[model samples]
Target chain A: MRGGAIAILAWATVLLVLFIGNWIWDAKPVNAATAAFAAVVTYATGVALWLARREALRPGPPAPRSEPESVPQSSLAAVLIGLSVGTILFGLAWANFLVYFGAGILVLSLGRLVLELRSERATRRRLLGEEEPR
Target chain B: MSVATAPRARLARRGGWPEALTSTDHKQIGLNLGACSLFFFLLGGVFALILRTQLAQSNMQVLSDNSYNEIFTMHGSTMIYLFVTPMAVAMATYLVPLQIGAVRLSAPRLSLAGFWTWLAGGLVMESSWLTADGAGRTGWSSYVPMSNSTNTPGVGQDLWVIGVILVALGLTAMSICVTVTVARRRAPGMALLRMPVFTWTALLSVLMIVAAFPMLILAMTLLFIDRTGAGHIYTGFAGAIDYQDLFWFFGHPVVYVMFFPYLGGAAEAVAVNAHKRWFGYTAFVVSIMMFSALSMAVWSHHMYTTGGVTNQYFAFTSTLLLVPAGIEYFDMIGTLIGGAIVLRASMLFALTFFLQFLVGGLSGVFVASPVLDYHAYGTYIVVAHFHYTLFAGSIFGFFAAAYHWFPKLTGALLREGLGKLQLAVMVIGTNLTFFPMFFLGNDGMPRRVSRYPTHPEWGTLNLLETIGAGIIALGVLIFLINVIVSLRRRIVAGDDPWLGHTLEWATTSPPPPLNFEAPLPPVRSYAPLLDLREQQLDRERRLEGAPA
Candidate 1:
């Protein structure tokens, strides 16, 4: 749930700023086509990532307790908030820069999820080694 | 085992080079192949640098078009046929048996025969380079009409035709040995999936060569027959592109055949250097197989702009090629995804290869689109594209594997710092040189031209490219220096310096006439040596706790 919320807020903040930046750059506003393309890519990727992360954190999942000792959820939430707020600030005038940063974070977030999965696998292997064989 | 060595046990080292030449021992044969391939590798590299230097500038004729053609042809022919293929074959004959618990290659005599034929063919091809018409001027692809007698004259091209067919025959013979050894000689417990990825790649490579080279032989023979005026085979209604169809029937798959071993070599090297098991061994192996099969289907991609071929069909196949190619990317990235990353000379080369081959592969995708193919085909863009594929994909893989295995082959570690410097320069110089050609090609520079006409605004890119060529030459020279110095001054590396898991590391630094005394036991996992190391640590810990 938290992952999805973070992803939505982050995605919206970045998109809103980029749209406004185009608003400022053009005589009226940037065309629907280019902005639409970027928005569609960003939003789809963001939502997918958020849903995946939220599924991982759900109580019934095998990894329900996996994040318990890792990073504090509150801190992750704080970081997400800061990024969302910063995007809202610079999203207009610095639309290009925001796009780069947002895309990077998007990719990095996906990578972190992957690394978490790998670590879980490694842990299961170690745990298997510790158990007595039948 | 005791048949031949008993006689020469006393007088063996006396004949030295001669004994090595006449040796039927698998190791000596391997050593010979390794040494000769190394010699040719450097030679091909020099040809490449010289050609690059020529194309670096607009055209004062450091070399003419024909000379450029010969140099490029020989460069490719030398690297793929003489150097890389034979080297891999040699490694297979020498190492795989040891790794697989075999006493020797399936038939050592056939291997020796293969070697002699290969050496002779290499000599014949090399000699043609010095001849009047100057050695197979029709590019390595040697497309028809251009390669046809009506267009190209002289015995030199004929010799290339004959020599390649001969070498291809020899390679076919060697491939059978490799296949039999793998199939028959693996340790009792080693199943197909359990075989090392290198061996898997080797087996697949030999298979490709066997199937494809026969077609190449058939094509070359038809051409040879036409040249002698025996029949009007290529002289008929289809003319040269018929030969193009026939040749690329062999030509396109041959590219991956030459490269797959290097790719296999790189995968193994990356696993060894990373000190972790390859992340997805099965996926990686499957990807190689995918590339091999998909490779044949996509040959028409090369014919996209060949004037009369259907662009629509070629473009469709080329795009479909991306799936298998992308799977390889997935496997490659997966291999390194979570392992402990070690940034050594070999690892650095592997990483750079990943970066460069990705770009190269992507550009290949771009060229696959029919519209783009229409614009870029026959231009310098195509040259830029393949050079990227060859250098970044194949040659870079070669350097990574060579540096990684140099110790195992020679019992000496290459100077790592120098190796890294050479790799960096190569990476930088390669991009600087070839990247601009994409622009030049887009701006309307045709390949195979000595001088650009005054109009195209090609001056600056050409100049920049030439400068990069010089740097690349220096970088390659540095690699040569590393090899030379390592011969005398380098640190001695015993077997298993990198903790290699396969059976090759189960013997001495430089193994004797026979690679091993007892065959290595099979493994449940790829990292047999790692398991051994962990066991040793556990034993030591237990010993320390004893009440002694």
Candidate 2:
């Protein structure tokens, strides 16, 4: 992750320059506001990365690593959540009953997602415990 | 490199449909996204052929005017949203992790969700054709005032808006994952500058997506609200201009989003086939950064004729794009100079991509001028310009990627003979189909019209374009056949078939679940494998000089 923050910040700076130019020359509220919002989002992303890891702002390659982490093989809940959102939006354009149906599925999927995540965390914990010295 | 094994033990293993549907593997997600995008590409191509048939001759009644409008709208929408944009993301999702030596994507489950959401959006959009009102008849841009309920009223139009919102949301979600992955997931020694050319391009594309796609989602959502009578958001002249500004902000960047990744693909193909590292690697990187940033500032150029934008500012930014574009061409030439050149299918496609995109770029310079744009604004010249860039340029580059990577993806070689044939036919068909439009537009033929008056050369040119469309379809058929034949015959491609420079080639063909089964080669440079090869050559020379 070394230099990650710098890259994002550099891009954000470019956007900021363009945003200022737009603000001065075009001066349309929507145009200026859109440009500003984009710059803010990019800056926020860079700042968040920097805050997460101070080394993200440092220049160089990352240190080599050997770390154990859980990788999910599959997740049905994720697919359901996505479909439910699409359904709710489509229902707004097509039928009212589908909205309720989609909302029901969304709640169920969220619950299922929580359970899946909990199970993944447990698995990770078990692996780490096994790796510890006796 | 260690992964928790307990999760596999805890979760039941499934295969076939269930596994394909629910797998969190980035490779699977990328494949699913790509296969669906290909299907949509074919669907959009059919729509294009239908339009071509209707315009084959003056006053041809192949389709009703309304039908023509719907087909044209769907054609642009399907190609842009469902095919090209997502395909770029699909390539990044699959290849970026492999290129950067990551074990997996940053958020696999979220990427799967994104895939499903995008597919659902595509389905919903296409389902509009089944509605009683036919389909969304407005152009893909669907400018406000005209797209309002009074002028264009129907469930189909509303459905189009909703579909667009969903697609934008899905693409944005997926793009965020890629951005985060690049930020957090590179292997040790794979510094930002040491990342592969394609990975850099993908990073810029996803960054643009994260920055611009929300504006699109917001625009579409407000349009839907306005259509549903919730509010009159776009009510005045200023509102109309506001809508255009917002749309073009996304619209213009999306063009580069579609181009940059394909450009990277073509660049890689060229470097590999030439037996040389990419020339001007650092300059190429800086140029694309400038290229991408200028892409954002040039959005207002699309609105120049509207008279509500600062034309001079936009025109200047739009024209400034040529500097970086010229640098890329120069880099390509530098790479080609005095290198061991191979005339492989992928190399040919890469060369064609550069040659054809030049025409598009030069035409862009002409149209970037406000004075010149006033003449070419709504004509077929604009149509020709974009087709050269998007279809002729990007599609050629896409084929270059496919031919170059099919072996790595499938552990098999595509039929080179068939590939060459397809490339030649496509090149002919593409130029024949789009090149004449420049002349037709110069003669004042407008776009989005189903028929034109019988002029001396208009009928002949339209006839040639229609024939060219068929030829392009034939070329695509040749490609499909090549894929089927190659996959079935099964000429096994081992790891590092092309002696590739990137990390993806350092592993098994098609890769394992974790991408690399063996330890990664030390990533000392962007082209680590190339460095290894050169070191071995130097060692052999030393041994020969020792007189052993």
Candidate 3:
């Protein structure tokens, strides 16, 4: 929607001001670093949104859409990827062999995730083609 | 022009656990996350009961010191990381898209992955109990020096550190999805400001989560490395103070992360039951932004006694928070005045949330002052203060949401009578359990102790608190029973039960996979359904007045 980037940017500016105040008052390196990092991350997100669409910074509701949107029903690859990461971390604390096993799963899941994305794009294309007036 | 939905082709429509676990639908993901959070809530409650039992009388020896330490740490950790914060996210994930008339979340697959990762983190954290030593005993904050490799060395603590990292990582990923959805997925007319009250609150919450949670991940990851002797990353006095700074940076905003969504839910419940649009909508939105921003800046208030930070700066920021806090209360009161107020269970809980949170907020102001905090810190007063806020306040708001949205979530109305009874019992139990701690804390009783030397007043109050904890448990049990009985009886809730004001009510109860099956009502205002009703009423009035 319009102004989404503006809102984020505005809030990030407020955080930056607060962080500046913190730096001036406390001057502790760790505290300053933490505040600075948060501010930067927020500002970076705002900038990314702005760059994605200039309209995101303008003020109004979004325009009505005509494009078809793909909605995936299920993503087993996503679940597997999540479990793999968790398993890899858990293995670090518990066992070494499990880490290798989780890595293998992660690789397979990534491949499946690519397949899902390609399929989703094809579904969107099909929907668009069906709607094209012959 | 209407938005068009593309059909799924290749994905198999499987049922049972596979579908439940792998579904990328925001609603399903939300429900899965919420169910897990509720389970953690009961788990956390059991931990609370154990703590209360141990503290019932001085030198009771209900559990050994080490065991007590583990229980208390897990109690705080489970409730914050697993229950309250995740519940807020679950509510937002499930309802924000529906409320804003979005078809689905941005990055749905990522959100699903986040859910699984978070669940695994919780399991890993709890699995610490099965270890040779025990679960984490260094408290939820897990400061350095005290939590260093030499002092509190164990695999359990290591697992806790890793678990916290995963939880933070997962929550961050999910929060990013919510944030992106809000920014990009609004219905045609649902502008940034015109998004419903709950969506605004949820937006702020996810933003805060995105801005703050990474610090926790960094803090935990470094703690793990420090614990494993990879590096003396946190060393000496500076290390301790640095760790606190890092932890509380995430820590303080998290309190609001646990709060804002529930507050939004309660606000919606109040407005709907009162049969009025939310009061001072622009002011309310602005205040929450200020409130959340101030919350991030005030983290060092927790470190005031440590003498490593500027007390005045933090205190000033913390005190400034009262301004926004006051605005919200004023808006709530303004909304209630001269409206068609209904004393539904949800409405009562909403009112109770405001009242109980006032107690917590006022107490917070006291501790926000360095002079006052010098006396209150590490005492039962601090414990009482936060419990009033987090438990009495946020949990009550959560219930308000539950009661208001239960129909929408499940297509069944929860038994009102049982709900009212549960509310009554919970209120009494909550007050009884937490109120006495203020008195006990003022009398110089320190917190985090398994045993204390016997004094009549302390003993009696602790006993009262233990009994109150039991009563609270009973109240929760009543609620569970109410849920079961209501679901079984199946009091079918129609599409627009309670004449709800938002876009979500325009759809069927337990909404379709795409959220809305019908074209969304024109979002001329935040409450599109209310706008439609008012327009209809105006038309009827004009026709009646005309000289036909």
TM-score of each: 0.74, 0.96, 0.96
Error of 3 at B48 (Å): 0.5
Ranking by DockQ: 2, 3, 1
Two-chain DockQ for each candidate model? 0.01, 0.55, 0.54
What level of docking quality does candidate 1 show? incorrect
Superior by DockQ: candidate 1 or candidate 2: 2
Report the lDDT of model 3 for residue B209: 89
Off by over 4 Å in 3: A49-65, B1-14, B546-548
Where model 1 places Cα greater than 4 Å from the true spot, the runs are A1-134, B1-15, B307-314, B455-457, B535-548
Comparing 2 with 3 on DockQ, the higher-scoring candidate is: 2
Query: C-alpha displacement of A108 in model 2, angstroms?
Result: 1.1
Local accuracy by lDDT, each model = 0.66, 0.88, 0.89
Best by DockQ: 2
- Write model 3 residue lDDT over B506-530, tens digit each, in one string: 8887788888777777778888889
> Which clashing pairs does model 1 show?
A17-A91
Clashes of each: 1, 0, 0
- Per-model TM-score of chain A alone? 0.32, 0.85, 0.82
Candidate 3, B546: how far from true, in Å? 7.2
In terms of lDDT, the best-performing candidate is 3
